[model samples]
Target: MDLTVKIKRYNPEKDDAPHWESYEVPADPLDSALALLLHVKWHIDGTLSLRKSCAHGICGSDAMQINGENKLACSVLVKDLVDDSGETVTFAPLPSAPVIKDLVIDQSRFFEKYRSVKPWLINDTPEPERERPQSPEEHEIIEDATKCIMCGACTHACPSTWADPDYLGPAAMLKAYRYTFDTRDDGTEERLDIVDSPDGLWKCYTIFNCNQACPKEIDITRWLSALKRRAVTSSASTAA
Candidate 1:
């Protein structure tokens, strides 16, 4: 199959503003959007630039707006996304982030939000003397949230993040909920504190864009709902 990819390009040094550039390329059933990007860089246009670490979608480097939705370019098959009109792929950097160049955004701000929630396992005890035991029931509580690859798709798709870039966004909130709900974690109180702020959980409007953009199928809204419930219940308990 043949494809026509229209990429929105921006270069502070050259162009006065962002513009679109189209390229025609070959496609196949096994072809990924990332593959088309590489083809563009190699054969169509060498100046086109994008980030991709693991072409298998583990690194989350190639997240971009494909046909209006934030998705991992490495994970989406061109054939699946193409309309009946055939191969016309639209590409752009993740929305709401400063575009560093074509198909690349300054991810520092995104990472900062991720760090604000302290995305890590925090337990009080030292290394387990023997083995840390957790039943499937306990582990299952946070299993969905743990699937996050930090792709920034959820963050990019969020309207709150678009309006207020400082908002921690759904990705970070989900990450916070991951540890907050973990049975082995001892930092639920602190994690809740991190998300209880104005820019944290309170900012989410429950639009569910994060849940829609998640490639891992993580129920971000569900986790966030649970967190909100815990917050309300905890406050009530403390008042009692």
Candidate 2:
């Protein structure tokens, strides 16, 4: 089937502002949006730019705004994007971040936020001869949180982060929750303090955009709610 793919294009060196460019490509209905993009890049326009490593969606590098929603281009089928009459599919760079080129946004801010929460296992306890052991129950608690691929979908979908770039956003807060709930991690107190600030978990406003935008199907709102509760309880205990 012939489909029109509209992409928002921007070249910092050439264009003063962004503009829209449309391409008509012969694409299979079963083909992914990324596939259509590849067709355009290979056949139509070699100058078109985007980012993708593992096209299977594990790398989360192809995240972009598709039909006004943040999602992985490799995972979204072209059929799903078309209506009954098969209208055109639109693609744009992730919002709230600097766009480097067509369909690509700078991820430096996203990674900085992720790093702020220290998304790693931190245990000051003395190490035994063998690796630390965790019960099945403990592992299950953080299993869903650990599924996060650090894709900027949730973060870009967040209005708070868009309004205030300093806000920690859902992805970082989710990472904070992941470690805070881990049985082996001993950095809960420190993590809580980091997220208790104005630009942290409290800024979420419970909009639920992060939850809706998560491609991994992870319930990010639930994790943020849990983090909020933990922060409140910790605050109350500290005051008392």
Candidate 3:
């Protein structure tokens, strides 16, 4: 089958503004959007630039706005986008960030927000000779969050992050939730302090855009609400 791919394109040195560019490419319904893009880059236009690695959905390097939602191009199948009457597939760089080129957005700010949350373990105790142990139940609490490859989809989908560039978006907040809730970690107080601020977890309005945008299918909104509750409880106890 032939698929019509419409990509939102931009080039800083050549284009005054981003524009739509389309290509008709033959593909299997089971073929990935990344495969189609690769075809275009290799055959149609060598100047087309987009980030992709592994091409297997694990790297999260190919996140893009597809069919008006944030998704990893490598994971979304061609058939999943086809409708009864609609035959067009649209690709744009992830929203809420500056576009660097054709279908690529600047992600430096996204990673900076991620680091602000301190995603690593924070146990200050002497290092154990063996790996620190965590119960199965405890590990399950963070299993979904651990699945995050820092794709920036959830963050780009967030309205709060769009409204306030300073807001430490869902990706960072989810990381905070993962570390703050870990039974083996002891950084809850510090992590909560960082997220409970004006531009932190409180900025989230529970709109659930992050839930819809996450290609991993992790219930980011639910976990974020969990973080909000944890923050509130921590504040109450600290006051008492």
Candidate 4:
């Protein structure tokens, strides 16, 4: 089927503001939106700009607003986008961030939030001769959170983050959850302090938009709720 892809385009050197540019391309029904994008760039316009790597959805680099929702372009099929009365598949850069060019948004702020949460393990204990041991049950607790690829979809979909850029956002909160729940991590209290502020866990309104946007299908809202519960319990215990 031939699909019309309407992409929002912006070039800082030329255009004062972003504008829409449409392209018609022949595509397999099973072809992904990323494939369609490549076709447009390869066949139609070489100047078209977008970011993609590992086109298999593992790298999370091709994230964009597809047909109104934030998704990894490589994971959305063209057939899935067409309706009973075929509509054009629209593409745009992720919301709530500065657009660098066509379908590419600045991610520096997102990474800064992730860094604030300290996404790595902090174990002060002496290194084991072999490796830090963990039971199957312990690993299971954080396995889902560990699946996060830092795609920024959840963060971009978050209304709170859109309203207040300082809000830690779902991606950072999930990272916090991952490390806080880890059996070997010794930074739970410090991490908790980082997320317990106004711009952190408390800012989440439980809208669940993050869960919908996540291509990894991680229940970001659930993890954020769990983090809230842990924060409350920790505060109560400390007071006592």
Candidate 5:
């Protein structure tokens, strides 16, 4: 099948603003969008820039806004995008972030918000003689949230993040939930303090855009709601 890929390009030193560039590719319908991008970079235009650590969708580095939705290029197939309407697929850097070059957006701010949630285990009581163990049931509670690859798709798709960049977006809140709900974690109170702030959890209006953009099929809005309830419940018990 023949596919036309439209990319939004930006060169900080050259163009004052981003612009559109298109490429015509003869490709298999089974080809991934990332595969198409690689084809363009390799054969069509060497200057075309994108980030892809693992084209299998593990790194989530190639996350971009495709057809007006944030998605991992590797997870999106050409056949799905190529309908009778047109065999054209539009690509842009993740929204609400500075464009670096072509399809790459500056993810520094995205990671900053992610780190603020303390995504790692926070048990500071003491080092156990053996690794702290968890049952399948306990791990399953947070299993979905743990699937996050920090793609920033959820955060970029979020209206709250767009309205106010300072707002702690869904990705971070999901990180908060990942550990806060983990029975092995001991920093629930500390993490909740950060998550309960005005610009943090409250900023999310439960729009569910994050849910749709997530490539992992994670129920992000649902997990965020669970975090909200957790904060309220934690605060109430403290008051009592």
Candidate 6:
């Protein structure tokens, strides 16, 4: 099948703003968005630049704006995207981040926010002589949050992140909840401090775009709700 892929191209050296460039790509029902991009790069525009590590959806490197939503290029099929009128898939860099070139975004701010969360579990006490004892019930609470691949899809789709770039964003907040829910983690109170202020959890507007954008199917809103509840109760309990 022939598919038209309309991509937004930008070059700091040449263009003042991004421009749309469409290409008719030979695609099958099984063709992925990433495959279409590769075809365009190889044939249409040799100057096109983007990021792709694994052709699979797991790497999160190919996350970009497709038809106004953040999604993994490898995960979205071209057949499902195109309309009956032969309208093409629209491609652009993820929102709220600086575009380095045509679909590639500067990830330094994303990574910096991730680091601010102190994503790893921190136990004040020393490790047990053997593995720390834990039950399946205890592990289950944090299981979904751990599925985050740091894709930045959720963050890019988040309205709060777009309004305030300093906001920790959904990915980091989900990571915060992962540890907050962990029975073994004793740092929840301290971690809450990091996300308690304006640029932290309070910035969230509950748009639910993060949950919608998550390829892992993680319930970011539910977890964020839980974190908010915990934060409130913890503060009350501490005051008492």
Instruction: Give the Cα error of residue 198 in candidate 5, in Å.
Output: 1.5
Query: Which lDDT tens digits does candidate 2 get at residues 147-237?
Result: 8988889999999989999899999999999999999899988999899998998898889999888889899999889999999999999
| Candidate 3 error regions (>4 Å) | none
lDDT per model vs. reference: 0.88, 0.90, 0.91, 0.92, 0.91, 0.88
Candidate 1 residue 120 Cα shift, in angstroms, is 2.0
Global Cα RMSD, each model: 1.4, 1.1, 1.1, 1.0, 1.0, 1.4
Q: List the lowest-lDDT window of 10 residues for candidate 2.
A: 78-87
Across residues 52-117, which tens digit of lDDT does each residue of candidate 3 receive?
A: 998888999999998898999999898888764378888999987999999888999999988888
On residues 1-240, what C-alpha lDDT tens digit does candidate 4 reach at each position? 788889999999999999999999898889999998999999999988999999998998999999889999999888888864386889999998999888889999999999999989999988989999999999999999989988899999999988999999999999999999999999999999999998999999999999999999999899899999999999999999
For candidate 4, the TM-score is 0.98
| Model 2: colliding residue pairs | none
The most accurate candidate by TM-score is 4
Model 3 residue 164 lDDT? 96
The number of the candidate with the highest lDDT is 4
TM-score for all predictions? 0.95, 0.97, 0.97, 0.98, 0.97, 0.96
Off by over 4 Å in 2: none
Model 5 misses residue 32 by how many Å?
0.3
Clashing pairs in 5: none
TM-score of 6: 0.96
Greater lDDT among 2 and 6 belongs to 2
Better of 2 and 4 by lDDT: 4
The TM-score measured for candidate 2 stands at 0.97
Clashes in model 6: which pairs? none
- Per-residue lDDT of candidate 1, residues 46-155 (tens digit): 99989999899788889999988999999998777785436688999999899889888999998898888877878868898797788999989988888899999999
Poorest stretch of ten by lDDT in candidate 5: 78-87
Q: What would the per-residue lDDT of candidate 6 be over residues 1-240, giving only the tens digit for each residue?
A: 887788999998899998999898888878888999999999988899999999888888999998878999998887777754356788999987998899999999989988887788889798889987779999998889888888899999998888889999999889999988888888888899898888999788888999999988899999998999999998999999
Model 3, residue 70: distance off in Å is 0.8
Better of 3 and 4 by TM-score: 4
Quote model 1's TM-score: 0.95
